[model samples]
Target: MEISVKDLTKKYKDKYALDHVSFSILEPKIYGLLGRNGAGKTTFMEILAGHILATSGEITINNENPFDNQHLIESICLIKEGNNFKRDLSIKNVLCIYSMFYPTWDPDLAEELVKIYGLDKKAKVKTLSKGMESALGIIVGLSSKAPITIFDEPYIGLDAAARRRFYEILLEEYEKEKRIIIFSTHLIDEVSLLFEEILIIQDGRLILREEADVLRHSTCAVTGSIQQVEAFSKDKKVLNKKELAGMMTAFVYCRKEEAVAEGLKAEGIPVQELMIHLTENKGA
Candidate 1:
């Protein structure tokens, strides 16, 4: 599935949740939707999911508008952190309802996941713990087999082992059947390996969109003598730096080949570090 978003804007009063954001995703792969807390990730996902309307702009899925379109809606599945189902309903009832909506829904897979997650079929939605609720959401999302599936912080209240199991299952499922999966999480370092591409939104703008490998290699840390580090970093885009005594360490945004020629010790920048350096309190 392909998505084309142009000049997308969502506003409330005088504030813009998404400000003229424009980007096109043509390939189907796992995408990491990342940003600080109020950075419009949810707004962008909601627009694509047709949960809310954009203040201005256009969104087309496979060249057709997804807004309230039944055909496209069936092809999309979005699982948020909380309460996506009726609290009074049983787990079995919830699965039955979702099965009717998603054409590719796998009841068998859902049942299997319910057992694996240790969720009782007779338990009401409200009777389950927070982690159980998230697990149920995960089951629906995976079993839906939607062409475009989104998980917005879907593992809340889960223990470390449970979280790891979900990650493993997610990757295993993705490999078996490829689709456009948009995953948003604050656990960047842990899930960085799962992303084929990365999209970073800051404030209400798209600040960075690049392939995972390209982004990782685009920046490097150079640590050596102050004079040599400064000489190499000159006329280059330096994301961050530190100087102590006679030593200097700088994170410079440049190609690996160029960094090798600088006569300094250099290492590829970590994804977490790159994100921090790029988005950390820009005004401060």
Candidate 2:
């Protein structure tokens, strides 16, 4: 399903959780919704999933407003930050209830995911560990087979090994089903390879949206002597820079060809590393 958000804004009295955010999501693509904590990713996802109303502006899925629209809501599934399941219900019962709600729910896939995540179907949700709860959320999010599926920090509290398993299964399912998947995660480097496109939000505003590989290739770090670095960075848009003794290093945003043609080597910097540096370094 194609999603269109036009001038979408969400406010909480004095704060704007989503500040006039607008973007369109083409179907059958995996999008990594990235931002620091309180960047409004969850707010945007909540509005998209129809769980909350936007303070202003609009959102449409297949040209229909999703807010309070059951037909549209049924096609969208969101696994948010907290546990929405009844604590007293067993894992199996929770899955059963979800199956009743979503017409496209795949029982086989849910069962397979439960086994894959090492979740005990008969165990009450209240008894499960944090990691197990996350696993359960992922299982339902993936197996629901909703056209527009959003996972907000779905792997929180999971160990490295379990997180890897979730990523693998997510990729496997996407390859077979070709559905839209929007994931909000702080673990960018670990899961970036799975995203076809990336949307970055900062301070409740959309910073940039582009193809993942293209976005990475569009920015690069150049290191050399202070003179050499400064000379090379003269005309480029530098995202960040640093100086150590007489040496200088700069991370700039420019076309790959232009950087190469300028005799500056452009290397692929991991998104997480780049974000950390960008967030910390303030040199213009």
Candidate 3:
């Protein structure tokens, strides 16, 4: 599905959760939806999945509005951090409900993941630990096989090993079948490798949207003597700067070739570093 958002805005009284955001997304690609807390990433995703109405502007999935559209809703899935299932329901019952809702639900895959995550089918959801709850959400998101699947912090309470398992399974599933996967996560460095494109939101506004490779190479850190670093930074968009004694490091948004030609050591900025520097408070 191709998703198009134009001037999308969501307001809560005098406050705006999303401020005139607009973007178009093509299907069968993994997108990293990155932002600080309260940056409207969830609001944007909820609007896209038709769970909430936009106060203004519009969104279309393959040229059709998704709001109250059951045909479109079934094709989209949004698995948030918690409250995905009723606490009193057994694991078996939850899966059965999901199977009924999503026509593409894979029973075999769900069963396999239940065993892998150590969730007994007869056990009530209320008795499961936090990590188990997260694991179940992951199972549903992956097994539903929805064309547009959004996972908002899907591995909240998981240990490192279990998180790695989720990542592995995510990659495995994507390799087998291509679909739109919008993943929101705080572990930028760990999960960045899976993203083909990245969207950055800051203060309820869309700040950056670029291919992962292009973004990594878009900015670089140059380190050298104060004079050399400052000289190299001239006329460039500097994202950050630090000085230690006579040495200086300037992270600038410019081509790698430009930084190297200016007689400074250039290092490609990692996604996590780029995000931090871009979103860091300027006044601080």
Candidate 4:
């Protein structure tokens, strides 16, 4: 399964929500879409899911345009942040309605997920707690078995334990069935380990796309005297920097060899701190 976006653009009023974005997603890997609020991640996902039309350019899944194409649409499922269903319907009725839409819906899996999430099938959607609603969303997403599953902040109302369970179940299902999953979330560090690749959108632009391991390996932290840190960071992309008294610490993002060689000379820096450095720099 391959999803290709070519010169995709989405505009609202005079502002470009997604500016000529292009990327290809190919088979069986989990991708993490990371960005700050209003950074175009949602726009891109909506376009890919065929929920909205792009202002210009094209998006194709398996060489077929996703927009208004029922065949392609059935193979793709998107769980958005606030996917509101009929508030009066019971959870079971909601699942039943969704089951008719997806060709690959798994009834057993949905039942199991309901049990795992501690959701009451007979409970009305309006009466269920916020966390329960999110769990229902998660259950539907996982059981749908769509080739392209896109989750946009699906764990919004989930507590820490519920979120952890969602992650575990997601990975377990992924391993069992090799499917393409694209997830957009602000909780980068919490779910970074599940991503095979990371796609970062910054200010309505595609900033970086790379393998997750490579991304982690490429960034490092250098802490020392202010002068030493400054000298070491020269010509390097310093994602973030801080000073305490006369000492300074810098998070340098560069090629592995470059960061390691420079760090060795300055003093060996720990790799475990790379995510913190990169995330801090991303915010900055």
Best by lDDT: 3
Q: Per-residue lDDT for 28-120 in model 2, tens only?
A: 899998888888989899889988999999989989889899999999999976686889999999999999989989999998889888888
Report the lDDT tens digits of candidate 3 across residue range 1-284: 89999999999999999999999997589999998899899999899989899999999999988999999999999999999899999999999999999999999999999999998889898999999999999999999999999999998899999999999999999999999999999999889999999999987889889999888878888889999988778887898899999999888888878877877788988898887877895531
Whole-model Cα lDDT per candidate? 0.90, 0.86, 0.91, 0.83
Q: Per-residue lDDT for 136-249 in model 1, tens only? A: 999999999999999999989899898888889889889999999999988888889899999988888888899998888788898889998899899988888899999999
Q: Residue 189 CA error for candidate 4 (Å)? A: 1.6
Order by TM-score, highest first: 3, 1, 2, 4
Residue clash pairs of candidate 1: none
Which numbered prediction scores highest in TM-score against the true structure?
A: 3
* Candidate 4 Cα outliers beyond 4 Å, as residue runs: 254-284
Q: In candidate 4, which residue pairs get closer than 3 Å at backbone N, Cα or C atoms, i.e. clash?
A: none
Give the better candidate number (3 or 4) by lDDT. 3
User: Candidates ranked by lDDT, best first?
Assistant: 3, 1, 2, 4
Where does candidate 1 stray beyond 4 Å? 256-261, 281-284
Q: Go through the candidates in order and give the C-alpha RMSD of each one to the true structure.
A: 1.7, 2.0, 1.6, 3.1
Across 111-144, the per-residue lDDT of candidate 4 in tens digits comes to 9999888888899999988888888889989999
Name the candidate, 1 or 2, with the larger lDDT value.
Answer: 1
Better of 2 and 3 by lDDT: 3
Model 3, poorest ten-residue lDDT window?
Answer: 275-284
